[model samples]
Target: MEIFLALLGFFSLGLIVWLLLKDYATPALAFISVSISVACILLILEQLGFGVGAA
Candidate 1:
């Protein structure tokens, strides 16, 4: 699980890098979108009992 999260984080950051490489509408939007995506991903994982508080 830890490794999975690490990889997911790397992939998320890489997505930002890719967006930065192109002419995205704005950096702010890209960051906001990715942040939201990460948040949702974490929440989903948590619901599946893979989060910090999971037993």
Candidate 2:
């Protein structure tokens, strides 16, 4: 489950980068979109009791 979320985040980040490089998104929009995705991933992990410091 954690791996899935991690992969999802990775793919999302990749997509965002592609969009920016392709001129499909503004810098601010890309930044905000990535930030929101990261925040959502963290929240999901936290809700699942997966702390960043955990092994």
Best by lDDT: 2
lDDT of 1 at 13: 70
TM-score to true structure, per model:
0.52, 0.51
Judged by TM-score, which candidate is best? 1
For residues 10-37, write the lDDT of model 1, one tens digit per residue.
6577567657754755777766667665
lDDT string for model 2 (12-36, tens) is 8756675666466777777776666
Q: What is the C-alpha lDDT of each candidate?
A: 0.64, 0.66
Candidate 1 regions with alpha-carbon error over 4 angstroms: 1-22, 53-55
Error of 1 at 25 (Å): 1.7
Give residue 33's error in model 2 in angstroms.
0.2
TM-score for candidate 2, residues paired by index = 0.51
TM-score of 1: 0.52
